[model samples]
Target: ITPASMTIVFLSITIGTIMTMSSSNWLMAWIGLELNMLAILPIISKPKTTRASEATTKYFLTQAIASAMMLLSSTINVWQTGNWNILELKNKFSTTIMALSLMMKMGAAPIHFWLPEVLQGTTLQTALLITTWQKIAPVTLMYMISNNIQPTILVSAGILSMIIGGLGGINQTQLRKMMAYSSINNLGWTITIMAFSPNMALMNICTYIIMTTPIFLMMTNMST
Candidate 1:
């Protein structure tokens, strides 16, 4: 993409997250999320290497499914309650679907199969972006609907993510791959805390991101 195009894509990504983060309705949030998804694929594919191609394809497929699930869940909620509010997801089935979709989107277990492979194939910068930046919208929406989702589901996924993150990386050779699992593990803590306290969940995410910064920077320096 040209510099101008890249600028527009990033702008779209920004607009998407802003919409989701600031909106009252699920429609606006869903739209924003789709825009972010569209913008990110191009950014991930810019290198045009075989590895980059594979990464973008995998990411697109995974996110497409997750996005579809979000749309479905939100629409179902609207149908059931005759409301479009993000903060008032009342349908039990819809809430479950939404939670599962977000877990998939965030690469939390047992739907986390794509994260490690995608990270292994993308550039260090892109992988880092996926690990941190791309998480905000889904996690924010998760926070919004946290009260509606089942705590048992969140707790189970959180525990599994932590377990997998720890066990899967025991023999990793690539630093990026290890960090991918670490991202999953850190996300587990956030999800676990989400069921009881959104504030603590956000805190966990913030602390994890801060800790990740220097590690990613060091990896970047090493790569260069």
Candidate 2:
């Protein structure tokens, strides 16, 4: 049941990613994000155990907050710029809002408190999906908007994620949580290079996935 539910969640997140990638409007992107969140809620709670329920609640609350922020940012952007086109972002305030929302969505630093806790509660395979496939959409969107995002904000978030991910992993007992932190650190590397070369960012993302897959598989095998 858990695996099946997770598969459905993965598919939903893929759909959300497609929506996000193809969306020209902010509202559409928000809808896609909401879809992703809603799909994953069940997966987070599938264990039918206390820890899973706690994690699901925490994830739900965190995602709800992020969704609210996304809505607020979109509303502000529309009000200030009188436009909803994702690529039409022009005002500094709107751009900043969009960036903040994306940062939160991608589990970037300072806004990344939910990731470890959530991963700690899930099965390893679910963690793999969250760390890998589920990340594709937001990161792709971030790469697309890299030119508009503030360099300082990206740098700060990237650095913080790297430091926190590395330091946080040192004491983690659960292997899944450790991998989640590793994913965060890798995301930091990807974001850091995004400012320098968009192509490099793409390369980093590809390489990270390729490298991380084997590690995740190994852990899954060992755990079982």
Candidate topping lDDT: 1
TM-score of 2: 0.91
Lowest lDDT block of 10, candidate 2: 94-103
Q: Model 1: which residue pairs collide?
A: none
Q: Highest TM-score among the candidates is held by which one? A: 1
Candidate 2 lDDT for residue 171: 96
**Predicted candidate 2 versus true structure: per-residue lDDT over 1-224, tens digit per residue:** 65776678778888987897788888888788889888878877878899888888887887788778767877877887898877766666766766666667677777888888888898877777778766776777677778887788778888988998899889988888888788888888888888778789888878988888888889889988
What does candidate 1's lDDT look like per residue over 146-193, in tens digits? Answer: 999989989998999999998888899988889989998888888999
List lDDT for all candidates, in order: 0.89, 0.80
Off by over 4 Å in 1: none
> How high is the lDDT of residue 135 in model 2?
74
TM-score of 1: 0.97
